[model samples]
Target: MSAIFYIDQLPNRTIDHDGQAYLFFSGTAYLGIPQHPDFHQLMAESMRRYGTVFGSSRNGNVRISVYEEAESMLATRIGAESALTLSSGMMAGQVVINWLQSQHYTFVYAPKAHPALWHAPTVTLPQLAFADWTAQLPGQLSALSPGPVAILVNSLDAVCSDYYDFDWINQLPDNRPITLIVDDSHGLGVLNNGRGIWPTILQKSVDKPASVRIVGTGSLAKGMGLPGGVVFGDANAIQSIRQTAFFGACSPMPPACLDAFLRADALYAEGQERLQRNIKLAEHLLLPTGLFHQASGYPVFFTEHDALYANLLQKNILIYSFAYPTAADRANTRIVISAFHEVADIEWLAESIFG
Candidate 1:
């Protein structure tokens, strides 16, 4: 049944289904902060400070400072020269692709990039085995493809949530003139001790003309429990996006969300610890179910997919089961765990799925 939520979906971490409260295990809020007292206060204070929407053009002389301030936090966290927030992570990707194509960049896609990325002029390379990244992807990228090449890759494959290694990105041959167009929507604030991996990647790759340049985009709506999208890179790339018609026409993020996000550093750190606990719980819960760990913020797919989906719901627990191109098998079934879940919630899901 189609339903409307009485609360923010992911942060609330509980769903009202059939007049019963079901533990919500369906969001990408790896650092679940919505239910936190601090988050509630932050949101309320934000509403008081900035009303609902800024609704002003950032291109104009006058714009919201929170925009830049929030972007600053994002850039600092990811170690980028600058950052921009757009309507969605997809918009951020669109901005990157548009700017790169305008600069004569061709596209090479890593396997299972989000469907949103395929809209660009892209060639899908054969799926390289995980280890092939250091050995294989580099060779492919090194080829003198026509024009500047943009390798669009997911830091974590959306299908099974496998983290693509960026460590070797710094090791690319100096002759390999490539820009890493990375979609980090899944990994930000969810992995690598809540700092994420992009900072390391960007820091490791220097600013030499022949060395690789990294442009990363992601969703704040997921792990950060906020609205809008982020694109961070060198000053030139961020400037290019700011000058675009897309930036001019798009609405800025809600002031309240930005306000809350700016004040959420502590909440995020605490939530990350809680999320780590939940991850461990999920690991233990599913250990005997024959479904191995896929990556952070998600669970594995197995023969128990159908039964577990129903059984978990019957036990007042809810996990998402949907068809995306990236599903573990052809089935597109999976489980998601969040910081909102307690040890009891994990235990309940385990018993329901395994029993």
Candidate 2:
């Protein structure tokens, strides 16, 4: 394995890694604000106003008005009724799973969904028989013992079907009640005109008999270029999860971090114009390689090749080579375009990839 090191050096969009500098075609800094000047200023101001850490959870002595305000903004953005802030998106998932376990509900999930969905103590449907999201969820729901069941879905996987199709998801047998939980960590800031998949699911899940619980988890670190996670859902469901023992036991995001996020939100709004530009650029750059095979919500294009990835890294470009759990398939790599990258950078990446 190659020795991993934190990126302490900033090279041009193309920089030297082993011996050559090449255009970077990988990694998930989608918005590219981590090193932006304005973001740096916001962080500096935040540090002065709100120290390094809050030292308590939302219910503790370190509570800040900004935390609540950020949550409200995020809820409004995602079209949820209320929102809760957490240390990370993984933590948000854990909170949701813990709550579901307390209710003693068996869970059925799309096999490609993030691991956090089934990592808790809940019973999961047989992994081999029901692995695909589009594989008729209603059939699986009918097979479960007569009782409450929760279905978790993720929209990020390349082979998975769209979870936003309301007509199909709501048709589960009327006799059995099921709650739908969606983890949109990858979908939140990059889909549905940037309003996210949460609001669409929330609106569609309203008439279900099982007392619909619509919850979404997102990380501000990805597209938003900030650190933190958000959980939003119906009012009562969020309240129930808050009472869990782990909910209030940890520290909250420092006011400074929240402040930086607030600024990042504004920058994100302005950065949309660049996002569109990069998407067009990527389509042109990657279409010829026959490797940019799929699109989920963002600009992370998937290609099947390990040597392409190692070559890119040798040129100092970082790309994500996340393999699917079912390893029998070909290894896939992801090509991400950051908002911080310029048009020249995109052209250079295209040349490098196709050279």
Candidate 3:
């Protein structure tokens, strides 16, 4: 592999090398708002108002009202009692896991939990259990020795499950005090009646027994086209986690970025109509590809390919490839369909993948 450290030298999404610009189908910027005029203007205005950087932690002089408002909006949108913003999704996961460890809790995880969840030093359950959508979740829950066990679940593909049915997941016997820590990075802004994943989970948490603690983490960089991550739950859980050493040490998000995210949230709400259209297009396109399988929430299509990494690159399509450190090498590639893609882009992608 070649050692490339900078973005400018790396392959640009649009290339003049081919004597014409071609659409790039790589990276997770599905919403295509990174360069949208409204988002751009909001970011530019924020920069002018707040300068480029905040240069302090949320606990210090850098915190802004916009940050608090955004958190509240996010919490309301996601159905959490409160929310905490972090510099990145990895930070969100790390801080949450740190809190979990401080509580002396063990984690039972699905095989597909993101690396951040697995990397946390507090994690105890070694081998992740695997199950498909049809598999009985209650059976799996019952099998676990009922102690201070917390199950780490990803929205989909983690347990080879569908949008986790709240009714089914909450069916954990009242006798068992298992916490459900979910990473809805993919599901947020794209699932749960198009209202986003966090709020749905929060509502479910509210309706469930008080003993069932629900924690959710997500990235704004994906569907929202903004950079940062959020961790949300009960105010006490959030407050407890925020007081940790790790949370205190990290720098807060830049004010301008936060402003941009606030705008992005509004735009995301408006863009839902278009998002639905794109989802339908993606499903139609993928259903014909015998190699592809449909997944609910987030316009993601899964397909198995041994040469996915090299092949997509050869076609100038950037995609996520799960390698050993990031993930166990699976014979599958996840293709994310953004609402920004044109109908032609979808057709072209289908041709490239199936032709």
Candidate 4:
């Protein structure tokens, strides 16, 4: 239980640990980008064309069109006025924190929110569930008026995969100005038909522009299967980060990753449908066993049963158990279903869990 090891190679769906083939269920590449040979060829072409890392300042006289190409596509798809690419999600979180810090805004966070947001001047009501916070948001806004307040949340939680219901934000009392920052790392490629949470949130908040300021930040690593992170928002907010954010001083994101990102729109379209189908297969089979619960359309399961975790492993199925960076309370076995997974693979894992 303590010394099993892993490495990435062929038959990526299964982990070779201590000379045994265990079904691997812990990867985050939801679309299974590596499985597409055409996509792989395109990525290889990009690597050849662009080299690897840029290793310099994007703010310098030199510029790469690939950054703009990917950011433009991302903004259009996410429904943001503009987007700024940073080195990583944690860096993007820092950029947002710095922006909010300069404005001296009060921050409120969801219990399961990313730890990066803890940097802000925050008020934590840990006893309140998400529903309670949403229900009481209007009044909280009223009492905290005469100052800017920000609410930071994981748009779709990584462990549970449940979204911070956009309808609740849309229902907020009118003219109550508040900044809403979303951590969308888990949602970018897998949610809303591969467009992410911002597009859907934008649609919901169409008539309330002055009431809500929507900001999204996340790594391209999770769903986009690319390198770096992004901060997306209205033009002013985006510019603030792009022009002078600390992340800019670091080496630019590897140009090779941007190469993959540029092709994601097309590959994602072909894969999202099958990925969704696989998720449903996971939902259908595992729920009946009483050992797991489906959390939204994503393959992640929230479970408290140690038997479910240990039994699945004994059956040679490998899944992730959350620790550290993932909130301690979210410690659960994650059964990942990728677009590359065969139907037989899905059924086998389900049967293993069912036993």
Q: How badly does each model clash, as a count of residue pairs?
A: 0, 1, 4, 0
Tens digits of lDDT, candidate 4, 40-72: 787888889888789788787888888888888
User: Which segments of candidate 3 are over 4 A away from where they belong?
Assistant: 1-22, 119-147, 158-162, 175-177, 202-207, 307-328, 352-354
lDDT of 3 by residue, 100-191 (tens): 77777767776557756764544443353344522555666677675666778775552222455555455565766667878877666667
Task: Give the candidate number with the greatest TM-score.
Answer: 4
Candidate 1 structure quality by residue, lDDT tens digits, 1-355: 2133455343356776556788777767667775677898999999998998777777877888888898888888877789999878777778777777777776777767765455545445456665664577656766756557777777776556565656666666566457877787877887666656676565656543565687888887778877778888888879878998768877777878888988788888888888878777777668667754465444332333455666666677767665555433344446777777788877877887766
Q: What C-alpha lDDT do the candidate models reach, one value each? A: 0.71, 0.68, 0.67, 0.75
Better of 1 and 2 by lDDT: 1
Task: Kindly give the stretch of ten consecutive residues in candidate 2 with the minimal lDDT sum.
Answer: 155-164
Best by lDDT: 4
TM-score of model 1 (CA atoms): 0.85
Candidate 2, residue 64: the lDDT equals: 85
Candidate 4, lDDT over the whole model:
0.75
Candidate 3 backbone collisions, by pair: 26-318, 78-198, 78-199, 79-199
Clash tally for model 3? 4
TM-score of 3: 0.81
For model 2, the stretches where C-alpha displacement exceeds 4 angstroms are: 1-6, 9-22, 121-132, 158-167, 202-210, 313-316, 322-331
